[model samples]
Target chain A: MEQALYQAAILTFEELGFIFPIERPSDDECENEESTRVSVKFNGSVSGEIVLQVENTILPTIASNMLGTEEPLEDEEILQDVLGELANVICGNTLPSIAGKNEVFRLEPPRKINKLEAGEKPAAIAHLDVEESRADVLLYLN
Target chain B: MKISSRSDDILITYALGSCLGITIFDPIAKVGGLLHVMLPASIVNPAKAANNPYMFVDTGVPELFKACYKAGAKKERLVLKVAGGASLQNNEDSDQFQIGKRNFLMLRKLLWKNNVLIKAHDVGENFSRTMLLEMSTGNVILKINNETTIL
Candidate 1:
């Protein structure tokens, strides 16, 4: 299961074109669980966590790539939507592997979490930080 | 046009990307309805019951069926056609978000318990799709990008 999760994560990262081998998030970086955090966690027959954070500099670039428009979108809602979609893609791509061959797994909707309140439980969290990009991805098992 | 009938025509449409859409229709009375549901069920937002009842599978399916029956559609004559469980770009990250699969499974479970059988369906894969159901003829057309296919 762990191997599957790792492969899924690596495959997702490569497909999305986001360079990684990146740093995993630390306690300090994720100080507040209540703050707006673009995190993806799975629970059910198969469970895990995936988190993403975008650098301020790369935010506009990613926004442009996602929207396919040169015009800037400064709205928080738009940014959140794009990030949510990104997380959704990552989760969808990794399911078959995590759930095993012929195992069907269902996913809940991607939601923005308060970072401060995220780690209250001692779960097996795999924190992934994509560097040189405007986004961050985190994964944990709770 | 949009055939909003209780039993015969249930027409629902939506932009589906890694999301599922379930449609239920009854032909005898020509009253049917469609639901562009995003999630498997409304576990997060019970507050949305009054306004967006169709957002969850459990709530929306029953409402759609009831609405059809009210319009003189018989449950025995109903034929179901489903579409819109598509995936986004393939990636590991995408697997963590299984709204499409969850939505599909939940709908199936609900329908099974109610003794409803899905006659036809198109689900899964990494493609964005749009679905439209013609209530008058019980015809379903799926559009993925520029390609159009009847399912």
Candidate 2:
């Protein structure tokens, strides 16, 4: 399940967000620990949440790439919306792989959130390096 | 879950859509704690709950209170504030999995059972929220749509 989720995230980033991710085993290989997070809750065939946390500095690049614009995006709102949309896309793609092709799933809108709290362990957490920025995806299945 | 005692520390919790963020602060003790709960019940996944109480409302709420007490925050002197419990926008047909509504109700139930009353709260909406607790003054700020509001 974790591997499936990681692949789905990579596909979404490359195809939809125009970003590429490289797997990193440790934070020492990345720049800093600071990140921006978003989560989308899903129901139907299965229930759980998909959370994506990305390094803050790379948000502008993500937003610009997703929008296909070269101009620098100075707006925080656009960047957050892009992050939420990316989480939504990742959840939509990952669910079918986990729940099977015959199952149907309904997803909640993605929202910007704080870091994952202690004790709420993710079923699968993947760390990806995106152009020197660190991005993590956590899957919590119920 | 996080706890703070220094006046300079600011506690914050984000992305409370369908989840709940709770804070308890005691001005006298100069202590504060923040908890972010993801689900309404631990019974669905008892194994996970056993190790991580903060994942469920029923189990997490109590543990949060206990932690505050341990940090020198008196129950009576504690000011409780809550935020989050938002559903997805344009998602009205699926009432069977209204996790946000359920999460909030469970929180209220547990708090009431403990004879604890919420001083302020923001719940049930289609918007995401980020909450902050300033330990210096016990003031809680809710951030939504890039605007901050006192709660």
What is the C-alpha lDDT profile of model 2 across A33-110, one tens digit per residue? Answer: 577888899999779999988888787777876675656465978878888998998898898888998898889989
List, residue by residue over B1-151, the lDDT tens digit for candidate 1. 1336533443657678756666656656666666677776676688895578788877888887887777777888888877766656576354665566667766765675577778998887777778877777767788878898878
Q: What is the lDDT of residue A49 in candidate 1?
A: 58
C-alpha positional error of residue B73 in candidate 1 after TM-score superposition, expressed in Å: 1.1
TM-score of each: 0.49, 0.51
lDDT of each: 0.61, 0.83
Per-residue error at B57 for model 2, in Å? 0.7
Residue B81 in candidate 1 has what lDDT? 74
Candidate 1 residue lDDT tens string, A29-93: 54432234576666667676555555545555455544545454567787777666667677666
Question: Distance from true position, residue A77, model 1, in Å?
Answer: 52
